[model samples]
Target: MSETSWITTPVTADILRGALELERTEHGVLPHRLPAWARAQSPDGQLAMAEAQPSGVRLVFRTRATAVELDTLRTRPAYPGIPPRADGVYDLLVDGRLFGRATGTGGNVLVLDTAAGTAETRPGPVGTVRFGGLPARVKDVEIWLPYNEITELVALRSNAPVESVPPGDRRVWVHHGSSISHGSNAASATTTWPALAASLGGAELVNLGLGGSALLDQFTARTIRGTAADLISLELGINLVNSDVMRLRAFTPAVHGFLDTIREGHPTTPLLVVSPLLCPIHEDTPGPGAADLSTGTLQFRATGDPAERAAGKLTLRVIRAELARIVEQRAADDPNLHHLDGRVLYGDADFAELPLPDGLHPDAATHERIGERFAKLAFGAGGPFAPR
Candidate 1:
């Protein structure tokens, strides 16, 4: 009971490595990308990260409501076609003991029940639930999903102590983007491009990827103003285009408003403004798809004969051009500010290389490609984002 005997060191990699191990399971928990955890389920399968070291911190998956279909993956094309829907209970276990359960149309809610400790749950399409107060030290974690379902589990992350690396060794990267950046179609928790980019760049990530929520709001910009980051990237345009969210007139001012707020706190930090990658659907076209708000479906149709281009539905080209202009104008006074064409990460040329299954976001392999490009371009040894 002596205080000296109770002293504990912070979480470290070595400590975590010695604490937990992942026993691969046929079922994995997918990353939740959309809002309210509703209408956000991707056709792609989910990727779950497992703990190699528990370090007294463990999170495991149990039963899932939707059948865990491995072939049905998001963020990329549906190779062999997307897997069929799953309907059943998938259970998660820790050391063979039930820790949580996911039940819903697409494995919506995860329920965790434990003692003493505190657990935090993030909302999903179904709902979110967490449990605390468990055996601090867990040895094994397991996932049980619908029968015949296989899951691709990504690297596990634990709340365990972090390694005692020097402050300089730790780099913080702040990124702002739409649903895609929020992980709309990525594989799992760690497979998102931002997550992958963070790992490749050796930087801690502050993902400001709000679903249907990245409207360049002043509130969002103000939020970034108060946060600290060593590197930052803003991926704009596509969401605005796809959603047919704004017109040229509104877009220009919104962009300025968003950047001005960030400038308030980060006058010199390296900033990169990225344009949207290519999407033929909205390249230079314009049209309001069958927006059956009643059913929440957007059936795109080519309604703008030839007059639309003459009129403008705010195509991607226009958006990209405006973004370039914004960055260029801002850069005249801010040397730390830079611009990267989102196409550089994934452009029309690469479309054939890695087509989106849903014809929107990049797939897992593409995510990796984009991550690598981001690291090399933004955080490479001699890149503009290198620590100064």
Candidate 2:
């Protein structure tokens, strides 16, 4: 498809309109905001875009560094002239073609002027600019970011006309997760494990893999609960582990709450909750938390201190076990709920083969491995995510 041909808004615009909800959540909206162009082509554009009106499916991509040092290095290796800024450069594609791109002048700096409510771009090491006003005309789109320059993609949006779409058997898969699921360190949006998995499984997708933003909040879960999807997966626990954001006592209930909210509307839909893959530091460790004395950022740290490690602080192994237990207990009453070990997607053995560059998030090869495993274990015939 031509990059510009992606403007098939008339067809996709309506499909998006039909799924909008009036209720709101921390993340806001049932359908969320249908891009103006996507809404303009529909019959109920006014309602679709009006107050409390549901909009389009939202795909958030977030990042949370397993190693605090990595978090400290965000957007570092500052491009020539740009004063290292968190924002990075990227390209967007739909299907197999280029759709749009975030422009970056190699030697430019981006200044975030919150007071002015606008960012100023000037010559520096690297510059970042967003590309919006997308067509929202198709069920699938691809996002490409400079792998060497940009470490991750934050989110994705679907503006397809959900309201007027011709009747068909197409089922949309709404996925939400952190940087790993968000296409971090991947060559392009299409190459992201989730995107690849969705394509390989033959399901349309709304990517909500927000980099550093998948904290399993009511808002995020509520957002997913209100949206429509045939399949939904929440790759929780990893971010929690890496961020050391909550204690063990709080982790279990948070997972339960997040899932409970999603279950409200998708009562019988296959819902998979995945625990974090193996990351040695948090695999069996605990935490009281460690402050990066250098930056005063309290990153998730494992107290190599044996006494502290034994205290049952929040750890990946602990979180994973707790999640499994919760799912097992809940599944007795909720048959649609399922649990999968993130290791099945990227295990310790797999890590030996393709160690994460930053010792936290998986590298490109690992992403490919994850995509394949997810496709087979989840999308294969008889699997929970398989089409009915």
Give me the candidate number with maximum TM-score. 2
User: For candidate 1, what is the lDDT?
Assistant: 0.53
lDDT of 2 by residue, 166-273 (tens): 434657788877768766666554667886787678776666665555677666676678788899998886667555667767777888888888889889989988
Off by over 4 Å in 1: 1-168, 287-306
Computed on alpha carbons, the lDDT of every model, listed in order, comes to 0.53, 0.56
What TM-score do all the candidates reach, one by one?
A: 0.59, 0.63
Candidate 2 global Cα RMSD: 11.6
Number of the predicted model whose lDDT against the real structure is largest: 2
For model 2, give the 10-residue run with minimal summed lDDT: 65-74
Model 1 TM-score? 0.59
lDDT of 1 by residue, 198-235 (tens): 76777766666654455675655766776777787888
Q: Show the lowest summed lDDT stretch of 10 residues, model 1.
A: 47-56
